[model samples]
Target: MKRFVLLVVVAGLAGGGYYAYRNQRAGTQQAQASAVSGPRAVPVEVASVETMTVNEEVEALGTLAADESVIIASEIAGRVVALGFKEGERVKAGQDLVKLDTAILDAELKQALADLGLARDTNERLRALVQRGSGTQVALDESTARLASSEARVQLAKAKLAQSTIVAPFSGVVGLRSVGIGDYVSVGKPLIVLTSIDPIKVDFRVPEIYLSRVKVGQPVQVRVDAVPDRTFTGQIFAIDPVVDVNGRAIRLRANVPNGDLALKPGLFARLSITVDQRENAMVIPEMAVVPDGVGKMIYVAENGKARRVAVELGKRLPGKVEVVGGLKPGMQIITAGQMRLRDGSTISVKEKPVQTSQL
Candidate 1:
C-alpha cells in the first residue's frame, strides 16, 4: 500500500513538470517571432507627386517715382505781372505759367530800335557820300561799325523781353506757386513744381547673382500699400550696369502706366520679377520636406513601406516646393505622421492618397 501511494505522487509530479516546460517553450517561440517581424505599421497621410507649370521669380522692394519731375524757376529778375496756370492744374508744353512785368523791357526795346534806325540812316548817308567822293573812307567805316552795334543791342533787348514770360517745359501737373502776382522774383527763384505721372517708374534692386537672368523688357508685378486692391504690371526698361559693391546688388527701373494719375512719386512699392518658367516641374507639398542636416529629405511610400530619399530643391511656391532631382511624378510622399517612420518602415495609410491636382 505505501509503494502504490509513492508511485502515484511521482507520476503527478512528472506530468506537472512536462506541462510547465511546454508553456515556457511556447512563450519563447512567440517572443522570437515578434522580434523578427519588427514594429507595427505606422499610420500616415500621403500626397502623390505631380508636374505643373512653375515660374522662377525673384522678389524685392522698390519705390514709385514720377516719369518726369522738375521745379519750375525764373530765368530773369522781374515783378510777376500775370499768373497763367492755377495751382495743381495740368499744363501743356510751351504754355505760359508766369509772366513778369515787361513794361521796362518794352521801353528798352523801343529805345534800341530808335537807335538802330538812326544808325542805319547815318550809315546810308555816309555810304552815299563816300560813293560820291564827298566823305572820307574812314568815316564810312566808323558808321558801319556803329550800325552793327545798334543791331546787336536790339536783339539783346528782344531776348530780355521774351525771358519775362516763363512757359511750361513739358506737359505735367503744376504744384503750388511760391510767387504771387505783383511779387518780385529773382533769377532761379522757385515758381512751382511740375511732375509727369503717366507711365510712372519704379526703382528697385536685386542680388547680383541674378544678373544673367534679368534683362530689359522682363515683366514685373508691382504692389503698394496705398493701393491695396490694385496690382500694377510693368516691364523693366533700365538696369544699372555697375553692381553695388556694398550690397552686392544691381539696380533696375521699370515703367508702369498711370494714365488715371493714381500712382504718385515716392510711394513705397513691392516688386516681383519673373526670371524664368518651367512647363513641367515636379512639386510636392512643403510640409513633406524634412530637414536632414544641411540637406533636405522626404519619405516616399513604396509597396506599403516608407523609403527615405534625399532631394535637391528648386524654387519654393506657396505651400509647395519644387523637386529638382531625386523624385519622379506619380510617387506618393508622406505629408503627415512621418515623425515615427524610419527607412523601410511599414506604413498604413489612414486615407486614400491625395492626388497632385488636389494639392
Candidate 2:
C-alpha cells in the first residue's frame, strides 16, 4: 500500500510538469505570430500632384556643325613662295592666302606678250603692203590669223599665272597651315581649313512617327555638353523629306545664332522640340514615378496605406513629368522608400510632402 501511494504521487508531479511546459511553448508561439502579423510602417517622402501647364516635347541627340566649312587646298602645284595670311586669322573673301613661285609663269607671259606685239606689227605692215599693191590678199589673211593666235596664247599664259596665287573663297577663320614659304606642294593638297561659326547648325534625327510634328520654323532648345549651363534656342530651318530606310528616322536641322562664338563644330548636343502643349495637366516630381514593365506605376498614399497606381506618362520635363492618366490632381504620392513598399503596406511620411505647384 505504501509503494502504490509513492508511485501515484510521482505520476501526478510528472503530468503537471508536462502540462506547464506545453502551455509555456504555446504562449511563446502566440507572441511570435502576433509580431509577424503586425508589420512596421516604412518611412518615405511624398509629393502631391497638381494641375499645371506642361509642354509636350520630343528629345533627340545632335551634333553642332559650322554654318559653312571648307578645306582650303591648292589648285595648281608649285613651290609655296610666300604665305600671305597667317594661320588661325580671319580672312575676307578673295584675300590672298598663299603665293606660289611665279617666275616661270611671268617669263612665259612676257614672251607671249612679245609674240602678240610682233604679230600685231606684222599684220599692220601686211595691210599697208596690200594697200600699196605690194602684198597679196592671201598673205594679209594669213597675217591676221597669226595675230589672233598670238592673242589666244597671251590669254592662256595670263590664266596660268593667276593660278600661282591661292585666294580665300569666302570670309571666315583660317585653320592650321600645312606648308611654309618655299615648301613644294602638289595640286589639291590641303592648305588650311575655313569655318563660318556664327549661326551654327545642329543636325539631329527623330523617329518617323514624329515626322508631322517637326516642321520648318518650329522652335527648338539646344544644350551642348561643352556648355552645360547655357541653353540655346533656334528654329527648325530644314527637315529631310525622306525617312531613313534603315533607321526609320527623319533628319532635322536647326540654326542657332552663335554671335558670341561660344559654340564650336563637332560638339555633342542635346535637343528638345516642343511638339504640343496641354493646359491644366497633372504633374509630379519625376522621382515619384516607378517604371513598370512596358508601363509606369506610382505609389499613392491613401489612409496610411500605399496604393499602387498605374499611370500613363507624357512629355518629360526637367525634374518633373506629365501624368497623362491614372493619377488625379491633389493626390499624394510616395517618392522615397518605394522599394520597401507594396500595395496596402503601411507608410509614415518622413518629411513635408513637396507641393506640385512648387515644382
Candidate 3:
C-alpha cells in the first residue's frame, strides 16, 4: 500500500512540472507580439518660413580681361640691335621699342642728300641763264624736273629709315620679351605683349533673361581671388547685341578702375549683379526645396501632417532660395526626414528651438 501511494505522489509531481513549462512558453510569446505592434515615432527636423529682403540676380562663369590688350609685333624685318625697354615695364605710346641695324639705310640717306644738293645748284644756275635768254625753255624745265626727282628720292630714303624702328601703338605695361638683342625679327613677328592694366577690364557674361537689366554704364561689382579682402567696382561699357545660341547668355564688358593695379588681367573673379529690388520675399532653406517634373516643390508641415506644396523658384542662393509662389510666410516646412514620409503622411514635428534665421 505504501508503494502504491509513492507512485501516485510521483505522477502528481510530474503532471505539475509539465503544466508550469507550458504556461511559461505561452506568456513569452504574448509579450513578444505586444512589443512588435504600434505606430513608431520617426525622428524629424522642422523649420518655419519668414519674410526677408532678397535681391534678384543671375550667375554665370566669366573670364577676366583687360580693357585693351594686344601683342605688339615688329613692323620691319631686320637684325634687332637695341632693345629700348625691359620686360614687364610700363611704356608710353609711340615709345621706340626695338631698333634694327640701320647702317645701310643711313648710307642711302646720305647719298640722297648729296644728290639733292647737286640738283638744287644746277636748277639755280639754269634759272639765271633762262632769265638772260642764254638757256632754252626746255633746259630750264629739265633742271626743275631734276630737283623734284631728287626731293622724291630723299623722302623715300627717310621712309626706309623709319621702318628700321618699332614703336608701341598704345600706352601700357609690356609682358615678357619674345625677342632678344641680335635676334632676327621678321615682319609680323611678335616682339612683346602689351596690355593696358590701369583701368583694367573684367569681361563677364550675363544671362539672356537679365538682358534688359544690363545697359551701357550699368555698374558691376568684382572680386579677385589673388587679392583678398578687397572689392572693386566697374561700369558696363559695352554689351553684345546678340546672345550666344549655345550658352544662351549675353556678352558683357565692364571697365574697373585698377589705378593701384591690384587687379591683374586674366585673373579669375567672383561677380555679383544687382538688377532690381524686391520686397517681402518668402525664403526657405535650399535643402527644404525638392525638384518635381518640369517644375519644383517643397514639403510643409500642416495639421501634424506632411503636405507637399509646389513652389516657383527664383534667384537660387547658396544656402537658401526664394519662393516665388505656392507658399506663404509663417508656414512650417519639413527640412529633415524626407525619406521617412510622403504627401499627407503623418509626422511628429519636434521643434528643436531652432532659429528662424537658420532656415
Candidate 4:
C-alpha cells in the first residue's frame, strides 16, 4: 500500500509541472504576437521645403592684400640726418619722409654754379674778341664747348642735391623705419614700407569650369578669419586669361573698400562669387539631406509615415541646399532623427515643422 501511494504522488507532481510549463509558453507566444502587430512610432524633427531665389556661388580661399604695396628704399647711399615723419603716420603724396646729410652735396652744387658762371663770362669775352678778329675761331669754339660742359655739370649737381630728400611716392601710411637718424644706408636698402589701405584687394583662384561665370564686375562676398564678425563686399576687377597648369584654375582679383582700415594685408580670407542666380528655387535644410548610396536622399513626413526620397542637388547656401529634383515645396522633410527610420516607417513629429530661412 505504501509503494502504491508513492507512485501516485510522483505521477501527480509530473502532470502539474507539465501543465504549468505549457501555460507559460502560451503566454509568451501571445505577448510576442502583440509586439509584432503594434510597433512604436519614430520621433523626429522636421522642416518644410521652401521656394526662393538662390545664387550659384563659387567658393574659394585667398589672402587679403593692399591696393598698392611698396617697400620704400634709398635711391642713393647717404647718412640719415633727419626723419621728417613719425612711424605709422599717414603721409600725403610727395611728403618728405627722410632727409640725408646735404653738406657735401651743397658744396658740390656751389662749385658747379661758380664754374658755369665763369665759363659763360669767358665764352662771351671770347666771342667779342673773335668779332674784333683778336681771338682765333678755335679758341671761341673751345670756350663754347667748356660752357656747355659746365652747364651739364651744374644740372647733374642739382639732381644729386634733390636725392638728399626722400619723399613718399603716394598717399599712404608709413610702416616701421629700418634706418634712423645718423645711420648710414646704401642704395637699394629698405627704409620703410608704405601701403594704401583705403581700397584693399584679394587674390584668389577658381576652377576653369567657372570661367564663363566669373567675369569683371561680378559681385563677391569676403570673410576673413581674423575679422570673424565682419563681412567685406567687393567686385571682380581683373582675371587672368591663362589657366594654371597644375591647379587647372584661373586666378582672379577683387577690389574691396576699407575706408576704416580694418582689413589688413596677408590675412586669410574666404570668398564667394555669385556666378549665377535662380529665381524661385526649391530649397531645403542641409541637415535633412541623407546619403543614399552614391547619391543623396531625404526623409519626408507624409500620411503618418516616413517617405524616403532621392534628391538631385544644386547650389549649397549657408544653412540650406538647393533641390533640383525629386522634391517639391510644402513637403515636410525630417531634419532630425532620420537615422533610426526606414521607408514607410511610422513617424511622430516631435514638434511642429519649422520653416527655413533664406540662407
For candidate 2, lDDT tens digit of each residue in 102-142? 88889999999999999999999999999999999999999
Please give the range of 10 consecutive residues that has the lowest summed lDDT in model 1: 350-359
lDDT of 1 by residue, 209-309 (tens): 99999999999999999999999999999999999999999999999989888888999999999999998899999999998987999999999999999
- Model 3: clashing residue pairs? none
* TM-score for candidate 1: 0.79
lDDT of 4 by residue, 234-325 (tens): 99999998999999999999999998888889999999999998998999999999998779999999988999999999988899999999
lDDT of 3 by residue, 251-284 (tens): 8887888877778878988777667668988889
Highest TM-score scorer:
1
Candidate 1 positional error at 115, Å:
2.7
Can you rank all candidates by TM-score, best first? 1, 4, 2, 3
Best by lDDT: 1
Identify the superior model by TM-score, candidate 1 or candidate 3: 1
Error of 4 at 313 (Å): 3.9
Mark the 10 consecutive residues where model 3 has the least summed lDDT.
Answer: 37-46
Which parts of model 4 have CA positions greater than 4 angstroms off? Answer: 1-51, 284-312, 317-359
lDDT of each model, Cα atoms only? 0.94, 0.90, 0.83, 0.92
Q: lDDT for model 4, please.
A: 0.92
